[model samples]
Target: MDTTFPRLLLQHASQRSSAPAMREKEYGIWQTLAWGELRSLVERIACGLHLAGLGRGEHMVVIGANRPRLYATMLAAQALGAIPIPLYQDAVAAECVLPIVNADVRFAFAEDQEQVDKLLEIRPQCPQLSAIYFDDARGLRNYDETGLHALDALIERGADFAKANPAWFEAEVGKARPDDVAAMFYTSGTTGQAKGVVHTHRSLLDRAKAGADFDALTGDEEVLAYLPPAWIGQNIFSYAQWLACGYVVNCPESAATVTIDLKEIGPTYYFAPPRVFEGLLTNVMIRMEDASAPKRKLFHAFMEVARRVGPALRDGKPTGMLDRIKYALGDWLVYGPLRNNLGLSRVRVAYTAGEAIGPDLFTFYRAIGVNLKQLYGSTETAVFVCMQPDHQVRPDTVGVPCNGVEIRVAGNGEVLVRSAGLLKEYYKNPEATAEVKTADGWYHTGDAGFLDAQGHLKIIDRAKDVGQLADGSLFAPKYIENKLKFFPHIKEAVAVGDRREKVCVMLNIDFEAVGNWAEKRNLPYAGYTDLAQKPEVYQLIRECVEKVNADLAADEKLAGSQIHRFLILHKELDADDGELTRTNKVRRGFIADKYGVLVDALYAGRTEQFIETVVKFEDGRSGRVSATLKIDDARTFAPMKAAA
Candidate 1:
C-alpha cells in the first residue's frame, strides 16, 4: 500500500478484483463496480487522456458534485501522470477563471451541462483552454462547439487507441513516480487570493494510511461521498483513504437526493463540518415540534436520560445499575430509532473539522451514541495533522498529533507542524510557499494553540483574530460566535472585546426558527422586533449563553472571552444595507461605526439603547425601521480546576 495511486489501483485489481471498489446511486438504484472493472475503466479513460495530448505533469480541471465518473476522471488524469485540479462546483463562472488561468489548464472534465457552460463562459478569459468533455449529455444535443465532446466519445476513441497500441496504458502508468505531483487544492481565499497547494503521491498516501490505521479502517468500511471533492477533507476521505483502505466509497444520486441516499447507504464512516451538523440537528428538532403532545413529552423525557448516561456508556465509564437500565430502555425506545432516522445507525466513526465545533453540538451526537469527534488540519497540511481517538473525545481540544506528525507552539502562540502530509509547495507562488514553510521543515499553521496537560492540542482561532483582554487573557471572537450560533435560535453573532474589560455581542435571531418556538408556546408577537424583545425569548437566549460560558470555563485559552452582555439587533445584517459584504460575511468595521452608540452602551454598562437600520426590498424600495434594544447580563463560570 506504500505506493502511488495508479500502482494501488493495479494492486487492488490483481489482489481483490472481484471485491466491490465503489458504488454509484442512479435512478434510485445502487450500481456497484468491482476492483477489476474500475481498473479497466481507468485504463480506457487514461488512454483517452493520453491520446488527447495530456502529457506527464500537465494539469486538467475537474468540476461538479461527487459523481462516480468525475472521480474516475481524476484517477484517469493521474493515471496518465497529469495533475487534477478540482474547482468548487457551486462557485460562479467568474470565480472559476482564476484557477483555470493560474494552473494554465488546457483540458477540463465537466459533470453536466451547467459545469460545461461555466467553462465555456470562462474560455475567453482562459484562452489556453482548448478541450472540454462533459459526463452527462442531456440538453446538449445541439451544442456543436469546437473542442467539445461527450465523455462516451472520448472512451470510444480511447478503446480504438488501446487496441492499436496494446502496451500504451501500462507503460504510461508504470512511469509515474511516488514524488510526482498528484493533485492541487486551492485555498478558500478568506485571507487573500487563492493559492494552489501542491501535494505529491508520497505525501497523500502516507497521510491517508496514517488516518486509516488510526481509525482501524478496512475495506469493509462504507463511506458516503457527499461533500464537494474540491475540498481537501472530502478528497482525503473519499479518494485518498478509499484507495488506501480499499473502502467502498458510495456516490449519492445528486445533491438534492443526498438525505435519502444517505439513509439507503447507511455509511459506516462519515465526515462533515460543524455547520452541516447544526443543520441536521435543526431539521430534527423542527420535525419533532410537529409530533403529538404525548410523543413530544416522551421524547424529551428520554432525551434527558440519554444526555446523562449515553456519553459515559459510550466511553466505557462506570455507571450505576439504574442509570444503565434506563439508558438501555431509552436506546430501544428513542435513541435507536432516532439514529436510524438520521441515517447514523451504521456509523462506526464520524468526524468534524474545518471550524471550531460548538460544545453543545458535539455533545448531542455523542449523547445519542454517534461516535462524533473532532480533528484539526487545513489545506496546507493535507487535512490530518491531529485527530481524536475513540473514547477520548472532547469538544475543546482537537486531539493529539496524528501518526508521524510532530507539533509545537511558536513564540507568538502559532502552532507548527512537521509531517509527511505537508504540501510540497504553492504552485507558481514560491514566495508564498516560503512564507509558511520555513527552512527547518516546519509548516507555520497560522493558528494560535497550545498543548494541554493531557497532551491534546487546543486551537483557539486564527492568530490574527486572537487577542488579549485588558486583563491579559485570551479573546477568540469566532469561538464564542460558533458556540452561540449552535443553539438554532441565534442566527448571526458578532462578538466585541479585543482589549476590553469583558466581552459582549450583538445577535440576530433566526426569525422563522424563533417564530416557530414562540408559536409552540402560544406566545404572540407583532413582528421580529416585538418577538426579539420578549423577556421569555431573552431567557431562552440567556440559557444558551450560559451554556457557552460553561464550556468556555473548561478551556484554558477562551475562559476570559465568555459573553458578559448581549443585545438582539432589531434587524438582520443585510448585504444590501452594506452591513455585510456581498458574500453575506459581516463587515465588522462598518457595523461598529454604524452602531457606535450601541458599542458604547455595552461597555458603559447601560441597560438599553435605541438603534435603527435601513431596509431594502427586492422591488428596489428602501425604508427605515427603528427599535429600542435591551441588553441583558449573562452569568459566567470560573475556570474548571485541573484534575489532580
Candidate 2:
C-alpha cells in the first residue's frame, strides 16, 4: 500500500468517491464535500501551485482555523513534494515571524484578512516569502496585491495550467516517496524558541495506522477538527489518522460555535487536551449549581450511583446485579442526558493528551461512560508513543507503549522512545535534533515517567520541571498543580519548592466561576484582580488548597509535597501574556521567572506582596496591572494511619 498522503487520498477517492470526506459548518448550515470533490479540489490546487512556480523542496506555511480548504492546501503542497508548516492562527505576528523566517517559507495560505495581515506585517522579516494566498476574501478587497492572491484564483489558474499540461500534476504526485519529509511542525516552545520537527510520510502514516487499528476506528467514524492544525497532535488525529482510516472530518464554524457544532455533529472519535475537558466539566458543575432543587437532588442521587459502578461496568468488571440495574436506571436519568448535553453521547473512543489530567476529572468521565482515556507523546514522536486500551484505562498511567513503539526509562528517569513514528530530524536545526535523538534511534521524550507493575506508563512531570525538596523528597509541581486545578475555582496554578523546605503555590482563579460564586453571595467586585483579592474569594480558594493537601497527605510518597503557602494571582494567566502556550499549556519557566517576586513572597512568609505586571492585550496593546496580592497559608493534613 502507498504510504504517501497523496496516493492514499487518491485511493480513497477512487474507492469511496461518493462518500462524505469532509464537512464544514458555514453560515448555520453543514456543507459536505465528497471524496471525489476533494480529489478534484486538491488536484486543481496542486496544479495551481506548480504553475505558480512552487517547486519540490520549497516550504509553504498554512495559517488558520480548521477549515476544509486549509487542509486540502496542505495535501496539495505535499503532492508537489513541498512541506507544509501550519502555524497557530491566533499567534501574534512576532511569534509567527521566527518559524516563517527560519523555515524560509516561499508560499503561505491564510484563512482571511486577519491572517493575511499578520503575514504582511511580518513579511519584511521573511524575505523568502514570495506569495500570500487567502481563502476568505472578505475584508481583503482593497488590500495590496503585490504578492497577494485569492485561493480560488489559484485553483482557477491550476485548472488552466492542467489543461495546458495535463500530465504535470500526476507526474509531481508520482514522485513522492515514503521517506520524503511529509510535513514540518513547530513545537509549542514552552521553554524557549520553537523548533520545526520534520516527519516523513512513513513516520506519520505508521503511527496513525497503529492508533486507528487499536481504537477500531472506521471510515464511518466522525471527528471535529477544531484544534489548531499547527499542533502535531491535531495533525496526527485530524489529518494523518483521518487519511489513513478514511474517516470523515468536520470543521466547526468558529471557535465560539464549537460546543453547538459538536452537538450537531456528535463526533464518534474525539480528542482534547485536559483543559478542554476541565472547562466542559466546570460548565456542567456550574449549571448544576443553578438547577432546581428537585433536579439537583436527582442529579446527585444518580451521580452517586454512577461514581460507584459506572467505571466498573465500563471496564467490564464484575458488579452485583442490583448495582448494575441501579447504574442502568441512573444512566437513563442522569448520565445519558448529561452526555447528550456535552455532545459526547456518540463518543466511542476519546482521548486527552498534552498534559496530565486531574485524576478525579479522568475518573468522572469514565464513571459517566465516556470511554475517556489518556495517551502520552510529543511532536518528536508523531504524537503516538503510548495509548490506553479500553478496559485498561487508568487515571494515573497514560497507557502501555503503542504498537511497534519501544519505551524505556533513562537512569535519570527520563522517558525515551524508539518508534516507527519518530521524527527524522528538526528541520535545519541538526544541533537541536541531535540533543534529543540519539545515534541508536532512541528519541529522548524529555518527560519523567516510569512503567508501573502492569506495564502502563505513568508520567510524573516534565523531566526539567521535576524537582526535589530540601530534604530530598520528590516535588512534582504539575502533580500538585493538577490537584489544585481539579477545583473549578482554581483555573491555573504554579507550585514552586525545588530545593526548598516545603511546597508553595501561586494560583489564578477562574474568573467566571469565582465571579458567579461571589455574585450569588451578594459580594460585589470590579474585575478579576478586584474580585480575586476579596476576603471571601481567598477563603473559598483556601478551602480548595486545603482539600488538595488532604488528598496529598493520603499518599505516603507525596504527603510532604502538599502546599504550605499559596496566593491568588493578581491576574489570569494568558497566552497573550506569554504565560501559556497557544494550546494553553503553562510556560512554567517563564511564569516562574516573570513572577519571581510572588514566588519569593510565598516562601518568605510575607503577608502581602505588591506587584505591577506588564500585560499584552488581544489588540496588540500593552498595559500594566498592579495589585497587592495576599499570601494565604493552608492547613496540611497529617498522613493517614496504615491499615490495622
Candidate 3:
C-alpha cells in the first residue's frame, strides 16, 4: 500500500513487466515501451543524474511537450529524491525566467533545439542553472557550449554509473517518504504573478487513487498526454493517475498533430478544457457547411433526433419504442461517425475543467454519446474537488464532492475545501500561502459556488470577478461570457460592467467558422481583420447578442446583466500579447488596462474607436496593428415579472 510515485512505479514494473506502460508517436508510427523497460530507463536516468551532481532535495526543471522521455525524466528525478518542476513549452523565454530563477533550478531538460536555445539565452540571467539537456539532438550537432549535453549521452553515463554502483539507485528510491514533496507546479496566474504550489506524495497519490476508483478505471485504460505537464490537472491525470492505476499513457508527436494522434490511439479516458471541445465542434460545423445539400440535410435531421434522445440513452433512462428506434437510426447515421471523426468514439469517461463550459456545448457531447462530464478544481487542491458521477451528471452542476474531500461555502460565497490532496504550501511565499490556507486547514478555493439540494456543486464564477452594477444588480461576467461563447461564431468574449450602468462586451470572432459563413454568402474578405470589420459580420453578431439578452430577461437574477453595447476586437486575444495566460485563461485586469480606450468609447456611446495594438510573433518579432472598430448596440428585453 505504498503511495509514493516511485514506489507505485516500481510495483507496477514488477507486477506488469511485459505490459505496455507508455507509447510515443514517432516518424508516423507508435513506439511502445514496456513496464520493465521503463523501470530500467528511469533507473539509469536517476543514476546518471546523481553522477552528474543532482543531489537529493535539489530541483530540476522540465520544459517540453508531452513526450515519453519528458515524462520519464520527471519520474527519474523522483526516483533520486529530487523534485521536478515542469514548465509550459509554449511560454516565451522572458515568461520562463521568473520560475527558473525562483525555483533555483540547477539542472534542466528541454524538448528540442527551440527550447534549448531559449534556456541558453536565459542562462546568463539564471546563474544557478548549471546544466541544460535536450532529448531531440536534431539542431545541436554544431553548437559547442558548456553545460549543454544530450539526454542520450546522460542516459549512457547513467547506465555506466548504475553498473558501477547498483545499490546507489535503489537506496535513493528507498529514502522517499509519503510526506516528501513529490512535485512543484506553477499556477496559471490569471489574476497576478504565478506562484509555485507544492504537493506531497501522499496528497497527490490519494487524490489520483480516489479519482481512478470513482470511475472504475483499470490498467487496461488508455489516455493521451497532450496538455502542458506544468498544469496540475495534466500532472494529476497523466503522471500520478497513470502510475496509481498502472494505465498506459500515450504521448502525441507534437501539438499540431494531436487530433490525428488521438484518432490513432483511441484513448478510453480523456480530459480537456472547454476551449478544446469548442474548437472541435467549430471545426465540425465549418466542414458541414461545405458538405453536399443531401449530406447537410442528413446531418441536421439526425442531429435533431440525437438532441431528443441521446442523453436519455446514455443515462439508461426509459424511452418509448418509437423514440428508441429513431435514436438507434440517428446513432448509426450521425453519432457514430461524428464520434469517430472527433476521436472520442472510445471515450469511456471524459471530464472538462478550469472554467464553466457552455451548457449547449456540454449537452452536445452527451447527446452524441460521448460521456463528457464536468469537474471543478484548482492547482491548490491537486485538481479534484468536485466530479460528476455517470448516472447523476447534470449540465449546470459539477456533481458531488470527490471521495476524501469536504466542501463548504464561506459567508462571502467563496468555496472552501479540506482534503488530503490539499497543497503543502506556496513555495517560499508564506504571506501568499497564509492568505488562502487558514489555521484550521481549510483551503480557500477563491471560486464562488453553492451546493444544491441534491448536494451538487454549481460554480457561479470567480469570487473576485463577480461585480455589482450601478443599479445594485448582481453581475457575473463569466456567466454572460459563457452565454456568448455558446454561439459558434463568437470564439472569445470579455464582459465589462462593474459599477457601470449596463453590461458591455468585447468580442473575438472564430476565424474559420465566421469566414466559412461569409464565403457561403459570396461576401469577399481579405483576412480576419477585414472580415471582422465587415458590416455584415456586425449584423450577425448583433443577432447573437440580442438572443443572449432575451435569455437573460427570462432570469430574474441576471436580467439586469444583459449586454447593451459591444464591439468586435481588432485582433484575437493572444498569449504572446498578454491578453491570455499560457493555459488560455483570460487576463481580465491586463486586458482591461491595455484596452482602456476601447472600454471608454463603449461607455461614452461613441460610434467608433481607434486603436493601435503592439503584438509579438512566434519568432519574437514585434509589430503594430491599427483599426477603427465600430461600436454596435443591441436591442434589450424587459425583465419578466415573477408570479405573486
As for lDDT, the candidate ahead, 1 or 2, is 2
lDDT of 1 by residue, 1-644 (tens): 34788888888999999999899988989999999988888888888888889888999999988877888889889989899998888666777888899999999999999889888888889999999999999888999888988899888888888889888877888889989999998887655577899999989988999899999999999999988899988999999999988989999988888889889999999998876787788878887898989989988999999888888888888999999998899899989999998899999999999878887788889988999989998888888999998878888899989999999899999999999989999999999999999998999999999999999999877887788799998888877888888888887788889899999999988887888899989999999999999999999999988998999899877888889999998888875576653233456667778888999999999999997777875433789889999999999999987788
**Model 3 lDDT tens row, 7-79:** 8888888898999999998988899999989988999888888889998888899999888888889999998
Quote each prediction's TM-score.
0.87, 0.98, 0.99
TM-score of 3: 0.99
Better of 1 and 3 by TM-score: 3
Task: Give the runs in model 1 whose Cα sits over 4 Å from its true position.
Answer: 470-473, 500-512, 518-644
Provide the overall lDDT of each model, using Cα atoms, as 2-decimal numbers: 0.88, 0.92, 0.92
Clashing pairs in 2: none
Report the Cα lDDT for candidate 3. Answer: 0.92
Report lDDT (Cα) of residue 44, candidate 3: 88
- By TM-score, how accurate is candidate 1? 0.87
